[model samples]
Target: MYRAIKYKIPVVTAWSAPGTALLVTLFPDISLNEAVAAYITSAVVIFFIGITGYFDKLLSWIPQEVAAGMMAGILLQFGLGLFTATDTMPYIVFGMLAVFLLAKRFSPRYAMVWVLIAGVVLSMLLGKINPVTADFSLAIPQFIAPEWTWSSTLNLALPLILVSLSGQFLPGMAIIKLSGYDMPAKPIISATSIASLAVACVGGITIVLASITAALCLGKDAHELKEKRYIAGVANGLFYILGGLFAGSIVMLFSLMPKELIAALAGLALLGAIATNISVAMGKESQRDAALITFLATASGMHFLGLSSVFWGICIGLVAHFLLSQKNRNAVPVTASDSKRV
Candidate 1:
């Protein structure tokens, strides 16, 4: 639902069915029962956090460059994923890359779309594309009566709140900020959290702001007229709905092609956004080192205290920046005294 109505700014949940399977394998006792319960509790907590509107105050203290740096580091992998994909599907990747380059050279804005076309057509010709075999089913919403326990609330619910806020929401807002959008923290938070809570009853886990996918829709490549870009987001949301309705069929269809094909297409599509953020991150001379710290930490994918690298990246960069600032301030008095003696 979030992806379907993302342009309307509803936050939705995402999942990896394989990851869920692994969770079941690891802890047979933990099942969808706990997931729905924990998810609802987490959403309530997040919604409370949003209503406080404290994040806006926090944002004021965080320099824009640091945020940009973290985002650049976060997205750098997507830009580089194309090369990794080339190792497996060289022909498709090569063809996509060629079209991407040509389209970029000529049109710049529509290059990524052209590359998608090239890849899909080439895949079809190579007999790599397969027809959808799965039958359609109405995605009837299901409900699970939540079992609220101290352990589940603490272990699962708390972590869900933390990870979703630090991992998904923060970076998503950063993307909006870097794109010159004015999305206030409170409204976006309240809106997504409410959406999350509403869906939790149906055993749904999401409708959160999307960082990577949002970048694709919000970037300059989406349209020449900047104001018109929201339309792209609307379209993306509509597609998400369509895809969800026929998820089994669509998943099988996407699964037929090489995973690398999709990665390459997405990577090529995001190149412009990635490059723009990198430029913004490292633009200022004074902020350069701090920005580098943020970038390296984020790109390194370090996670601590149950949060993602993006959060730690900002913390580390700010610490380094404060240390450097203090050192410079302390040196100023000594330099003045030395000059007076001379």
Candidate 2:
């Protein structure tokens, strides 16, 4: 629901990039079945929130700056991974950067894709890719019957849903607003949740609104006419379907790719999103303190009482916001629209 870059790729609900590394880290022993089941549960819960219009009610209390702050806090570390990767894989990183810049110069929308292609090529050339056994076959969906328990539901399903809300959905809603689109929140939320639930039976772990990625397609950069830009969304859905049709082979390709290569591509893809989110989070004078608190708390990677840092960030940010604002009684309150200017 948050920010979108110009990739125009299908925004998969559950992707395995470093983006969901927190989930992976939280559930170290996460099996495909468990992952899928957790996603299914989370998706269904989110769908209820959407259909009941509870998500809109929830958004009212959360100012856009705080939402953006939480998002930036969660995502800021992603861009930094690119710099870290550069220190170890100099040629591959440099090659990817070169391709990113060149692609941006020509076809700005596909710059991230080119960076990914560059990573694959350079990694292969540098002898980083491991040889894999060949299997020429159509991708078949493996039905994973889920096993759910109180502990599993609490730890896995809840966290996945929270992350989907804080990590993906909130910022997604903000970005859509910032882009000046009058889109309704619940319908999109319901659609994604239903999709995630359906896909989970076939091993998809999560599906969320491509918030940041959707921004790429929403802007004038995607199309000269704002109204026509929705074509990008349609195209993205097609890409998602195509990817699902070939999920098994895609998973194999991803698994065979070096961790560094995947990390580099992920980091590169996130640079623009990170910058934009930071700008939005820090732009307001009234909300700056709250935003900063949220960002730092999230970046600290705090986990408490079995909850992730993202939830803590929002809680801490709101506390900071209320406390600081109370102390500055003379100062005019910041409006949600005002915070969204960035």
Candidate 3:
């Protein structure tokens, strides 16, 4: 959701997806099953809602290259953050970077292949992986029995809608707009709302268009062939299906893989996406400073009021974008075109 909200890329979206799992670790009271359940629910919601195909329209808003560049910029810290946490991660970092850079330069279709190979090799060499512990539990849906509590629905659904608009839809539009798109916002937000409700029915938390991470897929830096961008959603959806089916096993496999490896692989995988976000965000004279600040702040790991840096960074970026835009209002008459830029 980061890219859709900000200007991050897709691989970074995958990396960020796993971040939800981090909550499980941090909150010892929450089981891995519960944490993953939320994600799975969100995926199902996203998939069904995506049937409308509105996202395709969003493609026109932003230039593919600029989107890709901004994506890479947004996720710059994730893959590298592994090294700070552990020594073994650096190896994965190297392998990930090597393959990712190679893919960007030569064959983007095989970028994920490089990451998988590196993960396998590194896990074997480092003794971080184990097939034995892999669990095979299917994630059966658990419906959250609805209670027509007006207070609850308003409190829950309203905020979710608002966040999806400001947090997810706005940035999603931004990614496309930054890339050079000019699609309508109503349909996109409407799709997200429908998706959120669907997922909520299946016990999902909130499923919005991923602004921050979707950029990874939409950006050119994601693959050597520019068209490979869509592969992100395809890959993510496939993984989501597989992940939901084998949630237990997936969790175990990741658990066996050292944290450092996961972090590095994630960071490396996101390199292209981050680079794209940064480049595009910097391209505009008016938005450059604010975008950079947002990029740095989001990448900085800072948090406030239980929200991640991504959330706070967007808030700061929006404020900056608004302030800067207003300041330039007299110097440069604001037009409908300029209004649509953010």
Candidates' C-alpha lDDT: 0.73, 0.72, 0.55
Q: What's model 1's overall lDDT? A: 0.73
Best by lDDT: 1
Q: For candidate 2, write residues 1-342 as lDDT tens digits.
A: 121223222232334222266466755566666666677788889899889998877777787778777767766776777778877788898788889889989988777777888888888888989878756466777788887766557767887777777667776676676566655567768877777777788767667765556656655556767666766776666776777677677788788887767667767777765777778888998899898898899888887875668768888988998888888997777899999995
TM-score of 3: 0.65
Distance from true location, Cα of 5 in model 2, Å: 18
lDDT of 1 at 162: 63
Q: Once all C-alphas are superposed, what RMSD does model 1 give against the true structure?
A: 3.8
Which candidate order results from sorting by TM-score in descending order?
Answer: 1, 2, 3
Least lDDT summed over 10 consecutive residues: which range in candidate 1?
10-19
lDDT of 3 by residue, 1-342 (tens): 322333223322222232333343345654334444444444444444445565455434333333333344346667557457456456665666676677757876566677777767867886666657445778787765544444333333333333343345545666655644454554554545455556655655555556555655665645555434555656676777787788767777777767766676666556555555666677777667677767776667664654555556666765676677678886856799989996
Residue 228 miss distance in model 2 (angstroms): 4.0
List RMSD in Å for every model shown: 3.8, 6.6, 8.5
